[model samples]
Target chain A: MDTQPFYVAALDGLFGSFPTDADSLWVMLIGSLVGASCALVGSFLILRRLSMLGDAISHAVLPGIVIAFLLTGSRNIFPMLIGAGALGLLTAFLTDSLHRYGKLQSDASIGVTFTWLFAVGVILISRFAGQVDLDTDCVLYGEIIFAPLDVLIIGDNEYGPRAVWMLGGVTLANLLFVVFGYKQLKVCAFDPELAASLGIKVSLWHYLLMGAVSMTTVGAFESVGAILVVAMLVVPPNIAYLLTDRLGLMIALAVFFGILSAVLGYWVAYWLDASVAGAMATVSGLLFVLVALFSPTHGVIARVVAQRRLGSSTIEFADSAPS
Target chain B: MNESSDLPPWLEFFTFSNVNVTFVFLGCVLLGMSTGVLGCFAFLRKRSLLGDALAHAALPGVCAAFLLTGTKNPLIILGGAMVSCWMGALSVELIVRYTRCKEDSALGMVLSVFFGVGIVLLTYIQRTGEAAQAGLDKFLFGQAAALVDRDVWTLGILSVLILVVVAIAYKEFKLFSFDPEFAAGIGLPVRLIEIILATLIVVAVGIGLQAVGVVLMAAMLVTPAAGARYWTERLGVMLVAAGSFGALSGGLGAYISYLSPKMPTGPWMVVAATILFVISFTFAPRRGVLPRVLRHFRFRRRTAEENVLRTLYLLGEPLGQWNDSFSTNELLQYRSMPTAQLAHTLNRLIHKALVKEPAQGRYALTDFGVTRAARVTRLHRLWELYLTRKLEIAPDHVHDDAEEIEHILTPELELRLEALLEHPDEDPHASRIPGRFVPGESGG
Candidate 1:
């Protein structure tokens, strides 16, 4: 029986009574992998200064999935995802094009595009209630509460949350892409104009990066939900930004932070018996705000503490060490 | 309204279908006027997006007002929206002024943290699930249809008051926007003026939250200013144009949304403003694509004519010669076929005696052509020298642009460049400087 928080399932009852220890193990394992992937993808988005773009994409992808269902006439995961992916690409293209050729400001383009897409989606759902079921209950928070139901059934009893598998696949693909083109992506991210002068096709890199973001978002949405995915994508990378100067380290720290948020979010959600996605997103946002205000390099509290430490250390070192 | 054409009978906007609809349009016009006027100053100051952050900041105030009054009076909510928006504005100003964070970071920080708090409060309210909490969530995504006539009247009056304040302070706002340092030097109360400007922004944003919502209200403020910028450089013209654009968009959006029932008017207004920017970007006379293309086409024609004259001059013909001007087909045989259009261009030149068909197959340079060609070549070599010496252009970088510029150099600019380069006779590779045949300066 699971008689502990998933992380402490190896011991005994810690926070909650689990009927099965294996269930808690599954939760921890799945949550960590999902968190790691969200964090890794989030790093580049934050660094590229498209952190809010993640927020927009997550919302816009909703209508895509809905449209996909209308076309494919089924709720199978893959077709629904493909439809969402296409919509995500369209939103990114429109947003980018508006900022470029349309001469609209980046924020306004983002603001208008996502809201329009969302409104259209909402209107469609209201108008075509019989055709689709994009219930607010399911889309906003996700069915992570029901994630364990759709296990890939083998012969007998070999079951797990279907979401974990989808997110795992996405996470691996994202890792492979970043690893293969880390150098090119880094240069392009830092300075697009200079990268162009060096003969890098900056536009191609932009589409590729946007594609990766879209994929990660859809996968994360399945695992957590659209709202939580944004928090997962935006918060960890932002926290990592506070921690380090190096991109690689920032990415690594972001993943670490992401896992922490996921584990915390799960317990919080369980404790409150509320929407897991909402709790996860809330917890993730709190982590970021805390890091923004208190991380060592630039945090307010860190600065004050560092100053006090410096004052005492200087006096001690001056008496003991040679100048 | 024409919008009624697109709607079902129950929702069709008759004049009396709802007086609230008229109020929405009027309120939008007043908001448009104030924001357009205020936005001109913000746009000039490159702080157009500050309204965006301030708009987001209003969310907390909205939540706080909910917590305090337990009343749904639009007035109480707006008061709260103003307070939170100003607090957010102040936080941003503090971060920028007192800390090392750049504008983007400070803006991002204030926007996210404030909104996060609002979201948490909103979620808390939802979780509490009081029946009244139903409308509480509407603040995130606004409901313009829910607005009552009284609500619209309040917004309308507030907007008018802001419009009056802006009109009266137009000169003061203009002075600070264009040159705050100058205004301060002249003792114009720059800080107080900025504070007033900030307060005006908070008011416009608060009024807009009821009609359009918060996340996008900034577009109402900034888009008109940005679109107007493409049309005019004069401050007065830009302000008027922006106000006019805002008014039209507001009325159109309000009428359409009123008829359609489900469409959000504020976003539609932003879309309309974006269309205006698109029009201006392509059509503005001074920097437009059409004018630039026309300039380029004319320059090409002029340059091709000069090239024909230089070729005849080089071939030692006082009359324009056919050395460079074979038939149109012969001229088309060049490596880059694009250059062959120069023959059609050269034919235009022949009519001017810059080139002439002295024989059936040949063209010769006139006396005027001979001097102009020599002068073009002289200017070409002189510029190469100046680049390699004074500007320190690499030895290899000088040839490409000079090949294009030489044929188009005006006599006046050529004289000035020659003096700037101290009358150099040799290019980077020791080419000859074309001596100026300046009418009186020929003696010098």
Candidate 2:
């Protein structure tokens, strides 16, 4: 019966300047960066109808990261990146070959490959729980609140949370790839055959794009876990695709939505005292629903309204034409 | 560790002596059978991931059911899961139908978002520190060993119910999967049938959730059906094969989990199913990859031998003697095939008694070989003449098309082509067409 208003409490928690609040801020920052980078590559994936491939890659990278950690007894980013990238490309290639040669449908092939890899990763983790640093719970939901504790200190100069720096580098790399290869990616995604006829190596660009996705997935893995990474990779670009036509505008909108979801999700989690990754995914889902309903150009409500107006205008034109 | 140390030995795990292991194994077998059968429809409909979305969507339902009832009854929780998953499936259908979003994107959105809500609720319940909510997290990655006798009974009854429904409506489901429009045209309630099928899938997912969990339940639904597809083309046979494969995987998975107390049943079960899928993909008789590859290799070898025979026949033709032997060097001027490959083909032909070597370097067709060669040449010329005369293709273009067709033409097709060509004696290239030889008669 005695409770503060939800919005006031949420706002206070988001902007409050307590020492513990720094952790929430870092969590939000890392989430935003990861979300942005995921969206950057995810736009191309959605455009190419490879949205499920993003889901597949996110799940398939689990074994790669676990194996990488086992080989090197630390959670170093480089080995994880290399391992996950290799597996991600392998996921794409295997899905393609199974569909082409094994005569399996694309969806079935994806479902088969990712689940098998994920099962292997989970079995390995459970079997060697004492030796592995990561646990199944961490791999499933992630412990982003603890991420800030793992600070990157160089010669007593603290460079903030290691996740923040790792995600920052990933975002920069994704931005560079997109900026330099925008034209080729656009052509290849829209019309692969035309791009090939125009002398562009469609498959090379495809693998390059998947490599970017792999690296981004690995970077985001430690913070959000695999399923939430899938949400981040798919939800934002999908929302953006519903609202825009041009690729450049779509990418920009996707990044904007990603950041918005992260900030809003952080506040929601702080108020509810729940998992931040879950809150973020929830917010992204909510954002998508909102855009699907209200976007001025392609939204359900807008189209319905436009149709009503068109009906009246046509009636008026008919009345005038008869006279 | 202390608890597992007191448990039975590894070999005894399979003996059905332990009440708990027996119940768990039976429950998993039933779960696998129902999901496998229902998944065949999903796979054929090209919506194989629907089960996955439905599984993830059931998470919040389980949590909500627990929060509301404050109990951990499997049936109650499963009921809640079915409702929630059905809502997710319906929303996906609505989204794809009304909006520009495709099914894959819609599936991804529903799966992650609903799971997110479920995670929030689950964490909320865990924080509340209710003793009743202790085993709720097991639904994420299932703990099959925790299944009691009552839970197993509940799962078995539900699975059998699903199987009965599918059995009674087999023809309807078959018609719906192969061609829904025709079913609808015939006044069948196509939409209702689809909903029934979708509900069956969700029910299967709901029951399996406690054993396989949400993350890997899709594997149970997809892998068995996919593996079964390689062994048969009949719907009935595929469904049965898939069910057996699923049951086998489930039993093996439960056994493995029993062997090591720390291991989860869901992943091991998935691993077992994947092994079966790999076996089917590699070794099944008709549609398996190995057989298809072998068939391709055999066809390639046959084509090579036929090409060599045609070449020798043509070379002997220019000398005005069909039975004359020709040297390998002399044959090389007309055909550009690799020498080693040509020699291998020659050896195979000799082994078949189609060709014989009179000297070390010279080869000639035997009486049987001449008759076979004339028949092959007749079919090739007939095709070339058909293309030039009926299709109006130029002579040069007809040769390339006829070259590939010459190896695969069946006898019935050759007869049809001969009848269509009115038994032409010459091709468009002004070369004489070989005719069939009677056994006692010389070359006509």
Candidate 3:
């Protein structure tokens, strides 16, 4: 695999040329930052059985991004983040409200809410096609290859990539939120009933988690697009979940896997000269497949081997004892 | 095309003289109709996200087929899409069955993973620089303007096949959707039926990829059926409504994009479907948000009116005066109601001929009003007595419980309470339980 020209060229292009090539370095850094931020909140979402809600939020935040662009009349990250974050929470609220009050099923409401919002976003993009230089294709799959070009500038000083700063701030905020609210989030995720019995406001923690997810999603959306954000949010954390039983360990493992995917995914995309976000998503999925099939305690192979051992030992015991 | 641009967009769209417009419009409508019918089954079975997963999953198949066959043939490409989409569904089932991952996690995983793989393949194709790859990217968001005679024919045949299959296996599909366990218990082949249904969904999703694209196709599948659900409870009616709503959105989407150059047809179709969903969710009769809210307000109003009438009867009970006029202030003292509310209730009661505002602000019960108010007070006091005696509730704690039950108790329950309490003469408060006859019968 290492001898292949595609592989060697990709490795050299991203790593051997690393010090000189700020483009590959920034794309990799930004991807890892986004991946790690998403994985932090995604762990709780998986524990709470709300993985699809993450997918829904990622799509539903589009209109908020579009509307922010429309209002601010520029691709300002702060306004887009605020706008999309608010809409993300609204998506969660509306989905829950429709389920609780409208008597619509939860899955159907999620489907309805996100798709509607995404449609509105797409329509807005087309309506203002001339006014805004927003590309629909970029929004769908993303072009992480161009992430370095959107550099942050501050008063005669070029501070790195804008996506890096945006994603880094979100990652820090997520870290603080998870650290401070760990106990409540754990209780709420594992058992809302018990959390309520203990006098914890389950809904407050639920919304807090939702807000964190929305904020993370908006920050990540620029580089990875919407759907691939789901891949980052769900796949890495899920792989970690299969590997560990403890909550703290799971969160740690998920972040590790997320960053690992970002690093490896960059190479894969460089090799294929394709979508870096898509490559990252594909790599994370492959990692999950590997873990699901080979995890020591819960893997399919372990279970199969255990069952086979039990079967053979029982047969031997029967033959020796007699009959 | 230049000459038609002079006419109103709506008029031109409806004219159907432009062959291209007619093909795209008809193609989208058929796609919508098929997806709508399939969406009902998916929605009922709680597999709405499966459609999303399948739609995203079909991407790799489309690209894979284009690479393998090196042709732009619609049938072959769609065939590849159907196969891979089916595999995606199978993988989700396998993951859930084999692993500890919940259904939603499995769905989210499969949906994004397959889409990622598809993106990789799509890029791989684009980088190869083949001339055929020019329009292949259209499958991502869909390009309805690309529909030709052949594409329309393919969509028509697929739509008809979907309609026929659903119609022929209506009972089986219905039973499988509402209660698959029972369908199996009754000796129906539930697994086979499930496969057939999955196949139907794959076909519906496959046909829609070229029109709504993969990302927005879930809306075409979900919004129409969800909207239709608000309009009816019966399965048959829901299917028809969903199909019509779907077709309407599809046609509207095509027309809007036609009117405005560069407007993508797929998202517009979704926007149109979402509008229908919002309308149905908020305004549909009986099950709609407005109707339910209206019913609640009306109930509250009725309860307020009855409470006022009960107060009027109770005020006159000790005085032994059924026709005596009382000021709004007096009624408020007895009932603890607002002065304005009392006046409003009095007006409504007068309108019903139950009360007469004989003076500027004073009111009195008519003969009919006395009878009506007596029934309300009797139910209230009767409930109090029953709660105290039968339920062993404290005599002092029965008023609040009785207040709520009085407004809700039916006539048959009133008689049952009468028999249960042996027709008590006095409530726990020692107030007279007004008799049903004239005031002289038992109050004093």
Q: Return the top candidate by TM-score.
A: 2
Per-residue CA lDDT of model 3 for B1-444, tens digit only, reads 748367777787788888888999999998888888889999997778888889888988989999999998878888999999999888887788777777778889999889888888898998889878887767656778887898889888989899999999999999989988899999999878978888888888888888777768888888899999999989999999999999999998899889886898988888899899889999999999989999999888888889888777777776778777888888888888777777777788899999887888778899999888888888889988888888889998999988898889899998888888887788988888877566565452
Best by lDDT: 3
Sorting all predicted structures by DockQ, with the top scorer first, yields 3, 2, 1
TM-score of 3: 0.88
Candidates 2 and 3 compared: the better one by TM-score is: 2
RMSD of 3: 4.5
Per-residue C-alpha lDDT of model 2 across residues B69-123, encoded as one tens digit per residue? 9988777888888899998999888778776777888888888888888888887
Positional deviation of A112 in candidate 3, in angstroms?
A: 2.2
Model 2 RMSD vs true structure = 4.2
Best of the two (2, 3) by lDDT? 3
Give the residue spans of candidate 2 off by over 4 A: A1-24, A73-82, A305-323, B1-15, B126-133, B259-262, B438-444
Cα error of candidate 3 at position B13, Å? 4.2
lDDT of 3 at B400: 90
* Candidate 1 vs 3: which has more lDDT: 3
lDDT of 1 by residue, A9-57 (tens): 6422454643235554556556667678877767777667666666667
CA RMSD, predictions in order: 6.1, 4.2, 4.5
Candidate 2 lDDT over A160-276, as tens digits, reads: 999899889999999999999999999999999999999999989988998898788767876667666778788899899889899999999999998988888777777777777
DockQ of each: 0.18, 0.55, 0.56
